[model samples]
Target: MRGAHPRVVLGLHRSRYERRPLTAALDLGVRAIDTAFNYHGFTAHQRLAKVAGDLLPRLTLSTKVGYFPGPDGAPQHSLAPSRLLAALEQTNQALGRPPNLVFLHNPEVSLHAPADAAREALSQACEALADASRRGWCESWGIASWDPTPLPDLIDDTTPAPCVLMVRSGLLAGIGTLDAADELTARWRPSAVWGMSPFGGNAEDPVWKTVDPRMFLQEPTAEVSRIQAAFRVAYDLPSVRTVAVGTDNPAHLQEVLQALDRDTDTAMLLKYRKLLRERHAAINGSEARP
Candidate 1:
């Protein structure tokens, strides 16, 4: 049996909704799972309940709400307080209990309004989730954003802070997005920060073959593959407390756990961040001059 590894969360974004993997995760002491309302064709929660309702109590469950089934049957994003609250109610029913944490999924997607209106819309949506938490709908609430650039500007005294703020992390994460995530973290001051999509949604991307991520480790080892190295370094790219990763293979989950034991080269990471900033600055400078 493996010891508990809380820092690694099993994300179900690309999961196959299999009971074996959920059981495998618990056996490996990976007790956290992240999912969203619209995943698996809006049936993820129901599927999970049917497949592994018994195992859920042993896991720290987190989910997101904001996307709903549209009139056309496709999922549509919204920040309406009533819609959000209704989804939270459905989430509790579908999972057979409240989630440990619930995030307002991708509010930026619907923030096409002017700055003031956008701020109001976001504040109301957050309040709905906050109220749900207080009412025992969930232990806590959070914000999970794929693009956090617009969020920092809209936050103010009236905006409720989330218990957790989840953003994309890893070698594939852009410098701009990383900087924005850091800024949002500072502004919101969440109790915890989480990183998602460390491989940018696909570990098999050709880009992984070109860059050797082991260089970011304090002491590179032949035992750690490039994928493991990349996953390990994601923790520091934007400085997150925990990361949400997805894999159905028990062997792959074990590989991720092994990467957690290796130390990251903070100095090397700082230098890389600096290089990225300089490159971004140069590109903007050239564009401004033209």
Candidate 2:
């Protein structure tokens, strides 16, 4: 079986945190919302609670931690157990309820310590989230890695496996990142895998104009917009079960949801991956020749 149809999550990374979008999402049957503690200047949770508290009960909420406000007002990534626990507490308080899932956001940014120390730090951080879940702070915990290349090596039998693993997805995702994400999935065996940044942060980027993503669809057609095809194909790029996408426009969100019914051409996806690998190897070989 091909498994259930992929789901779309309304990501708040670039959201205005307004009630209109939230209500539109619900109206479109998009009940899941993804946000990070550092979003909207670290006030996303509070703003969401204030603006759409009535609708929250109908949404499946997920949030991220790890980036804390620095002394200079800039954000700093940390893997300290204490900080993770504190952030989770604050997250619960700010939202007025526990989130359905809490992700340790972008821990790779802080894994510069030596291998052993880094492993220890990552384990402790994961344990902190797991512990918080045990205490009912959140329903579950996960890891959301923007760049997951460095994570697989640090994972061992003792490392706590997350319930979910969220990584970058779509055509813009590099070969190395796609491979690393697959490796991490193999090692951790999370219950679910999610893809994010299908448009690579901006759907209007000029690159979108040059590529015909419908080529990757099983039944390519001009009827489907390039953006919709790109969003549809993202689910197969890394084989994620859910994709978190950002858009304030209700029509755009609805168009994206329509993509879930379009089947991707798996053969085409495999060929593209092979081409990506060959091109990557050729570039590396050329650089080494000097």
Candidate 3:
């Protein structure tokens, strides 16, 4: 999962039919691909029915939960663990094979420990996952979150050890530079680190502007140049175990890989990204219709 081909982390929502970008990435030599149980549309679940086994054999399939639509526009985690279990069954049914890893979608609650005495919330999250596994939904499970600090509480006491992973704010952390903290680096090293944002931070980043708005399209915005520069710096020292770049577009992915091939330092990317982001933010802010 760490070595060899370039990893592709795709936020697959809803169907396998919409998997043209993923199918193309498979053709283009992309090895690792990600998805979630909650990404919904039309084709996000088709992989289960069609892509399982044969196509699934050569790739890493990751699915997650903890984020879904509710009646009002509020972030709700009130869905029962039974619902989570149902999602997993659906995922398995769709893929035709077991998912390699299961993660908590951008959980409003910390995948790492929260600042509050939220042990009850944490227990339910893992319990739901375990329940699914007991029911034969996945092969293994892991956590993807904003930071690793809060993760220890969840891991230190699991019945059967659970693998842990980190998810960073694609735009804010850029590339999770802090992944190298001596404490975590020693104990809870991640199997893979989710880059989460190719737009550098919410598709609003400048480097992502060149592509269409397709969820699967991964076009490079002005920030793409900066991000590669950032990778050059981050990858130089080898801070994280693996990097998951979301490639949703065939042409957009080409642009990203070509960009990475051009430059190799993430620090340099960050330097330029600062200026680019500021400019983009100002433009959007000024054009506010209000």
Candidate 4:
């Protein structure tokens, strides 16, 4: 398995939640820990190993690179050969082992781009990764895409092809990861699927902290408060199977796991959807009817 997934591994560089969740996953015997090269703080994975020594053996350990915004949070993606080499060396120090898999985090170019941007970027990244792999920096390389529109374009480009997808499948834009999954269903398959961000693309995660009074007006109170319920509702759609959670504490982790266990039936989802829609319509009517 690859590490550095948005959902599970989490970019622990600066977040307080990194330590506890990483510890929980390790204590549970999870071997893979995803991190990003851009993540600050010295040797994040090494720190994890020091804390959870016994769990290291099972860790598949993955790290990513290509962007970082100065403290302001600006982003960048650079796959230049020398830059990758430097990042590889830093990764080795952090994990104390060669990474199992590496991905180009939200590449600047796309094989699926209407223009040649992604195509060119894909080509350059593939070549750079190949050379890095031979030198023992990584064992494999893949791509992650949240957009469904580009899958076709990526397939058409041949050289340095994408082998995996770190997809954000069903969380947004309906239940279609068509951009990442469909084309790959044929010639290749994904190595890992790191999930992230809770509320569609809006990233409104408070839906998890507590049953905010605001959401109560949108649906049944009981359903609104169930985080595990929301997770199942989110994960149940066939579009999403692999998920990653970035809870900063165990109390939340417990909620997430609990929800994962509660089976979200299609009937329930349909009912919930209906409830939300009816609530919305009622609200709109009351406001519009004068």
Among all candidates shown, the one with the greatest TM-score: 1
**Model 4: how far is 73 from its true place, Å?**
9.2
Order the candidates by lDDT, highest first.
1, 2, 4, 3
Higher-ranked by lDDT: 3 or 4: 4
Which 10-residue span in candidate 1 carries the lowest summed lDDT?
Answer: 281-290
- Per-model TM-score versus the true fold: 0.96, 0.95, 0.63, 0.65
User: Could you tell me how far off, in angstroms, the CA of residue 208 lies in candidate 1 after the best superposition?
Assistant: 1.5
What lDDT tens digits, residue by residue, belong to model 4 across residues 1-290?
22322333433434452345666655543435566666554345566656655555666666676664445665555656567677777777766777777766666332445556666665677678767777878887766555544545544436465444555533232333432454554445454444544445333456445543222132334543445445545553323445644445555544555444344446555554455445555766742111
Q: What is the alpha-carbon lDDT of model 3 when measured against the actual structure?
A: 0.52
Segments in model 1 whose C-alpha atoms lie over 4 Å from true places: 286-290
RMSD of candidate 3 to the truth, in angstroms, is 8.6
Candidate 2 structure quality by residue, lDDT tens digits, 59-93: 89999999999999899999999999999999999
Per-residue alpha-carbon lDDT of model 1 for 115-141, expressed as tens digits? 999999999999999999999999999
Can you rank all candidates by TM-score, best first? 1, 2, 4, 3
Model 4 spans > 4 angstroms off:
1-14, 17-19, 41-55, 68-75, 108-114, 146-148, 161-163, 173-181, 184-187, 191-194, 198-225, 233-241, 262-290
Compare candidates 2 and 4 on TM-score and give the better one.
2
lDDT of 1: 0.92
